[model samples]
Target: MKNVLRIIGAILGIVLAVYLVYQLRTIFVYIILAVVLSLLGRPLMNLLGKIRIKNFRLPNSLSALIVLIVMILFVVGIFSLFVPLIAQQARIVSSIEANEVARAFAEPLNRFSQFLADYELTEERFDEHYFRAQIRDILKFGKVSSVFQSIFGVLGNLFIAIFSVLFMGFFFLRDGMLLQRILETLVPDAEVPHVRVILDNTKRLLTRYCFGLVIQVALVTLIISVSLKFFLGIENALIIGFMAGLLNLIPYLGPVMGAILGVIIVMLTNLDLNFYSELLPKSGWILVIFACMQLFDNMITQPVLFANVVNAHPLEIFIVISVAGTLYGITGMIIAIPSYTVLRIIAKELFSQYKVVSSLTRNL
Candidate 1:
C-alpha cells in the first residue's frame, strides 16, 4: 500500500511540475538564459573572487556584480560599435528602390526564366513586375512600415529580456550552489549522489563549452572581418563578418550560409554594370576568404572545442546535430550538441549500468 501511494505521489508530482513549467515558460526561458550567462561568466567571477584588495578578498556578491557589469559593458560596447553600421545598412536597404533592384538583376533572372520556359517549367518570361511581385510576396515588402514597427517592438522586448537575464544571472553567480541545494532537497535520498554528479558535470562541461563558443565566434568574426577589410576591401565588412559568425552557430550548414550571405551583401551593396568584370572577382575573393576561415575553424577551433572542452567525438556530435536538425529544423540543430552533452552526462551518472549509456559516456 505504501509503495502504491509513493508511485502515485511521484506521478502527481511530475504532472504538477510539468504544468508549472508550462505556465511559466517565458520566465523559464529567462532563467535558462541567466543560467547560461552565469556559466559563461563563471570563470571571470572566480578570478575576481581571487583578487585581493590589500588584505581582503573580494566577496562572491561583489565579484558577481563586477562580472555582470563587465559582461554588460562588453555587450553594450559591441552593439555600440556595430549598431550604427547595421543601421546604415538598413537605411541603405530601405532606400534602395525595388524597381531598381529588380532592374539590376533583370538580365540574369531573365536568363533563368528563359531556361525554365525552355524546359517547360514555366509558361511565361520573367520581367521586373513579376520579379518585384515575387520579392514583395516573399519579403512582405508591402508591409515595410509594419515590419519596421515589429522590429522596434522586438527591440523593446529584447531590453526586457536582457534585464531579466542579468538579474537572474547575478543571483546564479553569487549563490551558485543554491540550485544544487534545492535539487538535493527535492531529489530522493538514494538519487541525491547521482543528481549531484550530474549537476557538477553539467556545470563544468557547459561552462567550458559556452566559453569556448564565445572564443570561437569571436575568432571567426575577427578573421572574416580582417580578411574582408584588408584583402577584399568590402564595405560593411564588420556587419558581414559578424553575421557570418553568428550564423555559424548552426553547425555544418552555418559556414556555408555565412559565405553565401557575404557574397549577397557584396553584390547588393556593389551593384554596377561592371558586376561581371570587377565585382565578380571581388565576390570570388570573398568566397576564398570565407573558405579559409571555415577551414581554420574546422581544422583547429572545432577540434579543441569538441575534444578538449566538450569531450565528445566528432562523429557523435555530427550525427546528433544532423538528427536534431532533421527533426526540428535549425533551432534543433543549434541546440543539439549542448543538449546531447547534458543528456550524456546525466545518463552516465544515473544509468551507468546500461551498456550503451556506459559505452557512449565512457569519456565523460
Candidate 2:
C-alpha cells in the first residue's frame, strides 16, 4: 500500500511540475538570459571596480561606463565593416547561374549515374528525377519542416533574451551581491551553506567559460582572416572569418559548415582560376586555418582559459550535446554544456548533504 501510494504521488508530482514549467516558460527565459549576461559581464565589472580604487581618481561607475562604451564601439565597428561586404558577396552568389553549379557537378554525377546504370538504372532516374525527388519527398514528409519551425521559434525568442539580458545586466552590475544574499535567504538554515557554495562555484565556472569563449572567438577570427587574406587574396576574408567564428559557438559541426561556405565564396569569386589546382588549394587554406584554430582552442585556449569551468569529459560533453539537440534543436545544443554544468553543481551540493541518495547511486 505504501509503495502504491508513493508511485501515485510521484506521478502526480511530475504532472504538476510539467504543467508549472509550461506556464512559466516565458518568465523563465528572461531569468536565464539575465543569469547568462551577468556571467558574461561580471569579470569586466569587477576589474573596473578594482582599477578605480587603484587609480584613486576615477569612480568605479565611470570605469564601468567606459568599458561598456568601448565594448559597444568594438561590436558596432565589426558589424559595420563586415555586414555590407557579406551582403555584397551573398548577392554575387545568388546572381550566379544555376548552370554553373550544375556544370561543376555534372562530371562526377555522370560517373555516378554510369555506375548505377550498370545495375539497370539510368541518369534520369538516378540523378535528375527519382533520387532528387525522393530526397525532397523525404524532407517534406519527415522532420525537416518541424526542425525549421523550431529554429525560427528560437530566433523569435531572441528579442525576449536581449531584453532580459539588458534588464538583468543593470541590476547585476549594480546589486548582484545583494541578489545572492536574497537567494540565500530563501534556503533553510542547514542548506544555506551548501547552496552558497554551489552558487559560488557556478558563478566562477560560468564566468570563466564566457571569458574563454570571447578570447577563442577573437583569436580564431583573426587567424582565419589573416591566413585567407595572405594566402588567397580573398576580398571578403574578414566577413568569412567572422561568420566562421560566430558559427564556432555551435560547437563540433560549426567548423565544417564554415569551411564549406568559405570554399563556396572562393569558388564563386575566382571565376578565372583553375578549378582544381588554384581554386581547390585556396579553398584548402580555409580548412588549414580551421584546423590550426581548432588546435589552439582545444589545447591552449580552452585549457588555460576554461580549465575549471568545463570540467566534463569529451564523452560526457558529447552525450549532453546530442541529447539536448535531440530534444530542443540548436538553442538547446548551444546551451547544453552550461545547463549540464549547473545541474551537476546542484546535484553535487545536494548529494553531499544527503548520504542516503549518495549511497544508493555509488556508481554514478
Candidate 3:
C-alpha cells in the first residue's frame, strides 16, 4: 500500500511539473536564448576583462554591458544594410504586372503543359490566364500592404524577444558560475559531479558549434553574392545571397529551397526578357551557382563543422536532423545538432557503464 501511494504521488508530481513547464514555455525559450547568447559572448567578455588600466579592471557587469552594446550595434548595422534592399524588392514585386509576366513565360509554359499532357501527368491544360489572375490577386495593392503589415507585426514580436534575451544574457555573463551552483543544488549529491561534467561539455561543444555556424553562414553568403555579382551581373545579388544563406539553416531542405527561391526571384525580376533566350538560361545558371554553393557547404564547411566543432559523425548528425525535422519541422532541424550534442554528453556522463554510450561519446 505504501509503494502504491508513492507511485501515485510520483506520477502526480511529474504531471504537475509538465503542466507548469508548458505554461511557462515562453519564459523557458527566453532563458534558453539567454544561455546560448551568454555562451557565445563569453570570449568577448573574457577579452574585455584582460584590459587593465593602472591596477583597475572593468567589472564583470560593465564588461557584459559593453558586449551587449556591441552585439546590438552589429545587429542594427545588418538591418540598416538589408532593410532598404528588401523594401526595394517589395516595391518591385508589388509593381509587377501579372499579364506582362504571363506573356513573357507563355511559350515555355505552353510547352510544359503539352509535355505534361503527353506524359498523361496532368488532367487539364495549364491555363496562363488563370495563372495571371492568381498572380494579380496576390499582388493586389491591399494584399501587398497587408503583407508588409504582417511582417512588421512579426518584427515587433522578434524585437521584444531579442531584448528579453539580451537582458537575461547580461546577468548570465556577469554571474557565470551562478547557474552552475544553482544546478549543483538541484541535483543529488552523488550526481552533482556527473551533472557538472555534462554542463561543462555541453557549454564547450555548443560554443564551438555556434561560432562554426556563423562562419558557415558568412562564407556561404559571400560566395553566393560575389559569384552572382561578378559572373551573372545579378542586381539583387546581396539580397539573394542573404536569403539563401539564411534558408541554409533548415538542413537538407534548405539548399533546395534557397535554389528555388533564387531562380524564382531572378525570373520574376527579369520578366521583360524572352523566356527561352534570356530568362531561362540566366535562371539556370543561377541554380547551378547555388548548387555549387551547396556542394561546397556539404563537402567542406559541414564536414569541418561536424567533425571538429560538434565532434559528431556525419551519419549521426544526419539521422538526428532527419528525425527532428520529421517530428518538429524546420526549427527542430535547426536545433537538432546542439540538442543532440547536449544529450550525448549527459548520456555519457550518467550511463558510462553502457558500452554503446561509451563508444558513442568516447571523443566527447
lDDT agreement with native, every candidate? 0.84, 0.72, 0.85
Question: Which regions in candidate 2 have their CA more than 4 angstroms from the true location?
Answer: 1-26, 47-70, 115-157, 353-364
Please give the clash total of every predicted structure, in order: 0, 0, 0
Question: Cα lDDT of model 2 overall?
Answer: 0.72
Q: Write the per-residue lDDT of candidate 3 for residues 1-364, one digit (tens) a residue.
A: 9867855875696588658856896787788789999998899999999999999999999999999899889878987988899899978976778898888778877888889999999887776876788888887889979998999999999989998999899999998887789889986799798878888887888888888888888888889999999999999999999888889888889889988988888888988787878888898999899889988998899888767546767798799999989866887799888878877887788767778889888888
Residue-wise C-alpha lDDT for candidate 1, range 184-295, written one tens digit per residue: 9988899898888889888888887887788888999999999999887778899998998899988989999999998887887876646567877898998899889988
Models ranked on TM-score: 3, 1, 2
TM-score of each: 0.87, 0.75, 0.90
Give lDDT: candidate 3, residue 248.
89
Clashing pairs in 1: none
Error of 3 at 311 (Å): 3.4
- Give model 1's TM-score versus the native structure: 0.87
User: Which ranges of candidate 1 are over 4 A from the true structure?
Assistant: 1-25, 53-57, 135-142, 313-315, 326-329
Pairwise TM-score winner, candidates 2 and 3: 3
